[model samples]
Target: MRFDSVPMPTAVQARPRDSRGYPVPAITPWEGAEPQFALTDYGRSADCARGRLCSVCNELMPRGPVWRVVGGTESAAIAEALEAGRPYRNLAPTMEGPGHRACMLYASMVCPYLARPNARRGRTADGESELTSHLVRGTARGGRGAVVGFADYEFAITATQVLFRFLDVVEFLPHADADEHLGDLEAELARRQPR
Candidate 1:
């Protein structure tokens, strides 16, 4: 007796969702990076949660909530801007974006290199003393260091990392205190870092 050939059906699971029941979008599948010499690879950004994907997970931020990760001395300036009722609409000197608290915590625990000081290494067009004075006094203005809020933001994928250009400052609300958050992050980094 000859048996008939039949294909088996595969079981599929439903995608994950947040507490609100909105579908959670997955990160775009990696197609493998191109060789450096062959061609440049500027990563692409996807719009999500009225913002953009988190830099680490590439997942859309949850609606109505966001997290800002500050890695510099501009926290005081940002707080001052928010306090003084400034109408500034750019977070240029900031490396923050919409993110889940868990994701941010995981990144802080895992990435030790990011915890290092990242001051501009060399002299700028204004000369060494100018940059040194700025670093020393922490009075350098504009870019990520000066801006507090943005009306909207443009996300970019560069050769090395994701960028958020906060534009059109209508209002700025600092969700977390910079000094406390930085101290917490530093403590966590110290604990997590390999000796």
Candidate 2:
């Protein structure tokens, strides 16, 4: 299927609102090599029940719930790992988790500009480049370190290895550019949808 002409639903453009209909602000996206705080902190800011916040511009996130794509036993395993409080990395290898694979694939597909090492140079938001200094090293307890990449916000392969976490809470500058990119994505998806 051709994924090149679907329209983004208007709902995707709906700004998150409080009871009063005012916009809520998200925490600013990370700005340096070493994280200003824990990874969970960033996760909380982006995903907390309070509301969707942009990690980059510190603005309210545009409304659209995460669209999870999981298949087969991998889906069940991720849920199980989350419930067990065991790290996901321990389970990823066993299932060859499709969710993990999908996340990486999606990242590579959607942000082709980021896949090239040299492409990332000088790509900064507020003086912070696209890359984060926090490298995923071997875990002290067990399992491998979760690798994370950022284009707008933090995207990480969770330690559990069961899920690929994408934290796209940043407001890209040149709003028109972002809208254009979204239009392109929507068009692509529509093209892929079966007739």
- Quick one: best lDDT, which candidate? 1
Cα shift from native, residue 2, model 2 (Å): 20
Taken over the whole model, the C-alpha lDDT of each candidate is: 0.36, 0.29
- Per-residue accuracy of model 1 over 79-177 as CA lDDT, tens digit each: 666579764444453323444443444332222212223322222222233212343322222233221323445666544444455554443323222
How would you encode candidate 2's per-residue C-alpha lDDT over 39-71 as one tens digit per residue? 224344424323433332233434442322222
RMSD of each: 16.1, 14.5
How close to the true structure is residue 34 of candidate 1, measured as C-alpha lDDT?
A: 17
TM-score of 1: 0.38
The backbone clash count of each candidate, in order, is: 8, 17
lDDT of 2: 0.29
Error of 2 at 184 (Å): 8.9
- The alpha-carbon lDDT assigned to residue 75 of candidate 2 equals 35
Candidate 2 TM-score to native: 0.23
TM-score of each: 0.38, 0.23
Off-target runs (Cα >4 Å) in candidate 1 are 1-41, 44-51, 91-97, 116-152, 156-163, 167-195
State the RMSD for candidate 2: 14.5
